[model samples]
Target chain A: MKRIFASAHVKRLFSALAALAILELMTGPPGSALTPTAGFTGSFGEASSFFGIFRTQRWVVFLFLALAMYAIWSAWLMWGTQVRAATAKAVSVPRAASRTRPVRWGMAVAVLAVALLLPHLITDPFWQAAMVEQIAVYVLLALGLNVVVGFAGLLDLGFVAFYAIGAYTTAWVTGALPTAAPFGIHFNNFYAIPIAIALAMGSGIILGAPTLRLRGDYLAIVTLGFGEIITIFANNLYGITGGSQGTNTIPHFSLHVGPIKYLWGLTPVPYYYLTIVFVILFIAGFKLLEHSRVGRAWTAIREDEVAAESVGINPLKYKVMAFAIGASTAGFAGVVTASQSNTIFPSSFTLQFSINILVLVIFGGMGSITGVVLGAIVIQTGSMYLLHTPPAGYQPQDLYIYLGALLVVMMIFRPAGLVPSRRRHREIGLAEKGEGHMNEVLTGDTP
Target chain B: MSDKIFDVDHVTLRFGGVVSLNDVTLHQERGEILAVIGPNGAGKTSLFNSLTGVYQPQEGTITFQGSDAKPMSVIGKKPHRVSAAGVARTFQASRMFSALTAFENIKIGAESHRGIGVAGAMLRGPKTRRDERTSDARTVELLDFVGLRAKANVISSSLSYGDRRRLEIARGLATGPQVLLLDEPAAGTNPSEKLELTTLIRKVRDEMGVSILLIEHDMKLVMSLAERLYVLNFGSVIAQGTPEEIRANEKVIEAYLGSTATETGDRS
Candidate 1:
């Protein structure tokens, strides 16, 4: 119809096709025999030969294939946008009234059932252990990072330092290090869990106590430095940390209670279950903390620190608590990762890992537990899946480009995220409504 | 001295070389509504800051009636510590947590004074639960008192300007202070809202039995609401007397009221 031709979609399609044609013309053919040296001669024969090659059946087929791919991509984009807009309209209905208790309970039960049966249902060892379970570690990391960035409104750029601390603590305790243990004693990974968490929390306090006074960008820079310092120490400290090679062959999680005796092996299913249990516990605890006085205080501080202080909420104490609590989760994740792999390297604790976890939190919707968990699952699992079985003609490394594009698109369209918390949604709505700017003007917070 | 709840003895607060409050001294009698009226740059806010420990005075001492009946020196303490010592204040600009519900804002003020620790909050033990329940009840009560019970669940930012001022008062009352300092409470309010605020200030003094130290530019409200007035011009008190006496003082009129007489010209 005439409408379709006049539509913005058609314009986009034409532009995309035009770009592809330009690309085809410039590249000539894939791995063509014509070399760059043939260009310097300015020979008419060579130029005509190149044009002749472009006119061939193979070149024509390649151009047509590119065109078809662009058409499919454009169609997919249009469909995705339409579906999202429809869902957004639907979500405007009051959420609590729509979902009755029974429906909510049923959803919870279904999710639990799925989580419980996941490893068993996916009997493929590679997918279950290597892909799904590995992604779960990142999920835990994302959830913890959410506490710091999402709940406390602290931009902690060095969260992975806690992860490194946790991993290194496990290595030290389980006697995985080539160097002698401090007390020459080895403990089970099960025992190392608590120890690692404690150590990580202790380090969190140490880092937070001094640096928490520095807010926003300053805090982020300090945390960044802390993370780098941790990585550097892990890389250089041979006697205590085993240096760049890192620690390996850590003891597995085992218990020796009165009648019950169990030792986890290289099987990923048990580790997966272990992680899920902790995740559930953290989610529950976080939910409680979210509604408690501490949570209210955090929210108040996040909104306005001076107001919070006037009401007697010490910004430092709550911020430090957030840091320690967030760090504990990262420590928990590190312990799980180390036990699962029976090794951890300094190289694994990179700034890129921190950024990846932050992306998961942002992608899911900060401050929403479900959002963070789902975000971690979707992004981490999707990336791992892509790496394991990349699409034809696409390299595994191309995942970053896709991720970058996804982030850009998400920021442009849905900045509140995939599953924003009620508070976050309200905040975003207020900002969009220009209330935030009005507030800044009224309060003389012009900067 | 025994009846005085807050005594500022020659307090001089300076920011670098610029003197904000130069040797200012005043005292509030227990359960009395007192007002400090002055021009725009008259150091009224600086005095409030000194009293609240936001800025420690360079000279002299601020004395508050402690639990032992003896007046204790409260100079140089932190702002939160000052609140803990039973001196609550509301800012000139309404500073309620804009994102929080009105109830939550009041609850924070109550909880801060209630002494619930992080461990107690997390554990939610019987004691913590009891504290929380009581605090919630108190928050509801304060909301009712402020006539904002209907808007308790509404976010503070969404409330009208008058409602935000009332919520700020409710939050301040939640701190359970012996004396409350209100900075420019009538600022930006319409005549009806100003009347409501004046009645609330009186009710706070008479019913709640909390001494009020108010800073105001509205001379009519100050003259009507305050039992006694402290007239300040250039950070020094020119006169301290009953409204009748302050109204007749030539020095007070020449220094302050002469310039802003048109605004307060209706006073007979």
Candidate 2:
């Protein structure tokens, strides 16, 4: 019996069973928020709405549906390898090699053109706001977190803390908060940019200096604690931070140069353009750093610290640098967000926000610039769409359930993510073959 | 000014109740091949770790004399600092950045000596570009020197065992070290590969003019390659001399071959 249970097929079946249980638990009974009504009536009825259609959730029917989906997924898992192999053999030239430089350049130009025109093309003011709020801002957050989690192989759970710091710094600088600004003089929102970035980077270094010596899990726990501490401070420090009420009169960005004066107002289009410019600048800068000596050092340290040290690469220095660099991006993002909304709330920066950005990084492809950008766009758009036209029986709380399901599916199918960095793709491929170091995938133990 | 590359004096490293290296003293002459051979738990690796600044000895001092500089102390410095001070080493088990290609692996070592900071890398200014070009050229040169130039694009993990060992040597040399410590470079290689490795080691010492300190259990390789040998047992050096002199010594034979008596069974 033990031998039978130990068989690979049996183990796979057990995993499928586990997945079914979790999915069932997450999905629950398809109804409105549960009430203690005895009768099958109103919101408590078994017949609940889905996509504007009232559907009955009989046990037998739901089970059959879940089982059918599981069966198809299993079939794909079993047959996908052969299909992929057959197609690979049929295609003589590699996919990447087939796309010549000029073609790639043309594609890039087209993408930029679309991005530049997107805000103007969308007539709805709501979507224009969403594009900047839900998508662009999150993309910046994800890109910053990617440097820590994706590039440096650090699981930083306190990433949103930096964002909070940036926002609060902006608030303080603009005299929105009760605390006096530096030199006892209030500054415009634009002047807060450099101060916020410097403070965020300084905080990152301070947090990282001693704690980065801790390996994997301990480091993660430390970062998690840091995140909690920041939130608590923001909530309790009522005199300085405005506490849970948050800072409400943070001013919008303004420019005052010789013969040129402009003030950004409530219109989201101009803010979108400004954000696009910063995002482009950051992407270009990060792309350059990714292929340079610093990037190589991070990769080396991530791969093997001892070996990196032997080769004269100081591990702690690079790790701290990663943290500071990552934090600066988040800091700038905080500035953008605080100024755009003209109000700051401690509730907006939460542990959940950090995890959400991490999800974006993982879903997009951790270390791939293009991947994370696309991931943010797709996920934010989907979530916004859901909010705009929520299905019957849907609640704001149920969004995580769908996101969890999507992540699980992604992990099972494309473990490296939607558009994995080339090295990451190769590593995952090797792990599948049981050749490369697989602990990162299986045990969450980084080398 | 002695021409000794590494000067160790009565170093002791202890972990709790156990002593890994007990009052170990050794020295390596400039531009010479030295070997330390020992059985399991003989503290050869501990001595190497101490020398490379991975472990701090509880007692004594280790001084390193570069080609033309003052004899600087190596006892308290960190590994990278020691490496920057012209000391580089490899592990008993190869620890290549498995995901990186051979060229990239070498380039990392080559670029480590000097380069621009994060801001410069992000900026991609002339200095950063020039540094990158120099490292690239150095990587190619080292690849050719180790005769892995053709396989430069191959991932380090995907290379054959012998090729990986060669790649590691190439990587160590890329650091521009005055002294290279190799830990069991011939462990997993076949006889022909071992012969190639021996030639490569000699080439490294002769052409690059780098001093070598090797740790190996392979007696033939050690005897053929090293000018002098140190035999260690129970965290202490039992014998040290020219291989010819050490080979014929009773203490050395007893330590390595054990006492030729049946009564001393466990010791043997």
Candidate 3:
């Protein structure tokens, strides 16, 4: 009770009441007057009447404003002190390696359980399917983009080109479009997956071969052009791609082994399971790649290209390989998405989709597989949730405004992201330490 | 091994109109320490860059005598290719992969020589696993040699100045090169650290049979450690001889030492 009545809480409560009173006055009395309630007569009469009105409602408004200002000022002071204390504690604590095998295994098991139970827990077919198609696809895309941007330190803004190529490959191979099919060939979606992945990787090499030499912004521009080119091609190639109409009647994923046969239908639960399996496989593969020799080379190149070359690392070869590997994941995702929807459209492969995937990767923490996954789930599911059950006066488009604000705040406060990779965390921490050292030097204090 | 390990024949490198190296010629005999000493901007680093394929000389040929009999022309080759052909180099500013661990940095060098392909790395096949194991063992051995075994797992950026230089040398050695180029390896190091570096350089040459071509400004370190010396001035070789002869040469003293001929003065 004493703590509740402390200065801070009391001040906050008082400000709340004061704000309510001001809102009531601004809204006016219960019934609409339809005109000015206080009538002014002559100069002296008007002055006296205005003063009378000010003595009541206007004075309450002044008190409300003062209380609100005090509340905000006190809150700001508390926040400032708390931030300083947290920063001091963070700097003093030695970084402890927390990636013990048992802990990792526990996380893996927990994730697996969640993935297995998710379809059953969400009985709503529409949401279940939406979760699989929208969230899962972005998760896969984010993971792929993570390899390019986070692991290899290549800022690829046109990652969706690979995704589009994968979907188109599936559409062509599965004979989805009557006019666009090659020799009217029809194949299982499962069979088309490998072909789609191969084609995507090939395209990756072709695009990366010439442009991998371009660094930073130049590379990003070239990739953006590549993505635009692919979309333009899809839109224009009427004979092969069905152009604006897009390929439809694409076959769904099916399996026919000796004794059992299964076909994925309108219900998204089966597709969800299939995508979950691939996600697990990819996570394992990406984790393995992260710890391997290739991963070391990527780290070396990312840190310093000239140093990497002096040590005999062929930067071009490794960079192209990263592109191809990253593309392969998007290709797989594309195949899953095309099959799930039973269609592939050039309109579907927009630059916004690429940016959305990149946003998830950034939000989750680059170079972290689990971070990307969680980021995808949170952002995608959260946005969809808002769209379905928005508050009064809220629209689905408002999600972008919220996301933009969140990104700005994240960049300022936690640039390494929510679940940063160990290396990234250390890099950011060391950079901050350098800033602190500079401050000490400027102040003539010993570090 | 043959007597001649690296042969730089009349190499001339120019960027626009400024001649960084003007018809400069030098050589390193097998298993010997050769030092190139010059005043600042006197084309010492230009020569190192030429040999390492960072810059291709407009004229003359740079040759490396590998295990094979033929000397490979390395003038126009890529940097990685040059490194692959039995020559490795350390940077003047200690160019380490700052984000990677010291062990991992050395391992990258060793793996570059071992030649594990993308598929092999992804699959972790038997051959790749064996190669990785061998490289890891070699990395540990090199770290021990450079006296950085305690900081093997520490990030390269966090290493002390002296240790970072030593780590660069270890990374160079991990490439299993026939000739190792050290560019101001003793820069920023204290006297005791410099002594340790000198001893380590001698050990690398005598025990490992790796020829060293060093570019340094520290006159005392160069005079004490180098068996032979080449002095440069204004992008041209002014004197080349035994360290004792070069030290006594009047032209070298006038042009390079500049009347502050006290050999014990700190040059770095």
Question: Candidate 2, which segments miss by more than 4 Å at Cα?
Answer: A1-79, A89-94, A97-99, A429-447, B259-268
Candidate 1 lDDT, tens digit per residue, B135-250? 99999999999899999899888998888888988898898888888999988899999999989988888888888999998888888899999987888888999988887888
Q: Estimate, for each residue in A1-447, the C-alpha lDDT of model 1 and write its tens digit.
A: 899989977777676666555444433322336753322222222325643543434345445666786777777786978887888888867566447888777887899899899888888777877643467788788889888988888888899999988888888888888766548888778778899899999999999999988766677789889999999999998887888998777877887999999877667788888888888888878877888888888887777776666667777888999999999999999998888788888998888888888889989998788899888988877887776775423456566766876787687777767888877777667767756322221122221
Q: Arrange candidates, best TM-score first.
A: 2, 1, 3
Ranking by lDDT: 2, 3, 1
lDDT of each: 0.80, 0.84, 0.82
Tell me how candidate 1 scores on lDDT.
0.80
lDDT of 3 at B186: 90
**Chain B TM (all candidates):** 0.95, 0.95, 0.96
TM-score of 2: 0.91
Chain B, candidate 1: TM-score:
0.95
List of clashing residue pairs for candidate 1: none
Worst 10 residues of 3 chain A by lDDT: A436-445
Report how far off residue B3 is in candidate 3 (Å).
2.4
Q: List where candidate 1 sits over 4 angstroms from the true fold.
A: A1-94, A97-101, A131-133, A432-447, B66-72, B116-119, B259-268
Candidate 2 docking category?
medium
Flag regions of model 3 displaced more than 4 Å.
A1-98, A178-183, A431-447, B262-268
iRMSD (1 decimal) for each model: 2.1, 1.5, 3.4
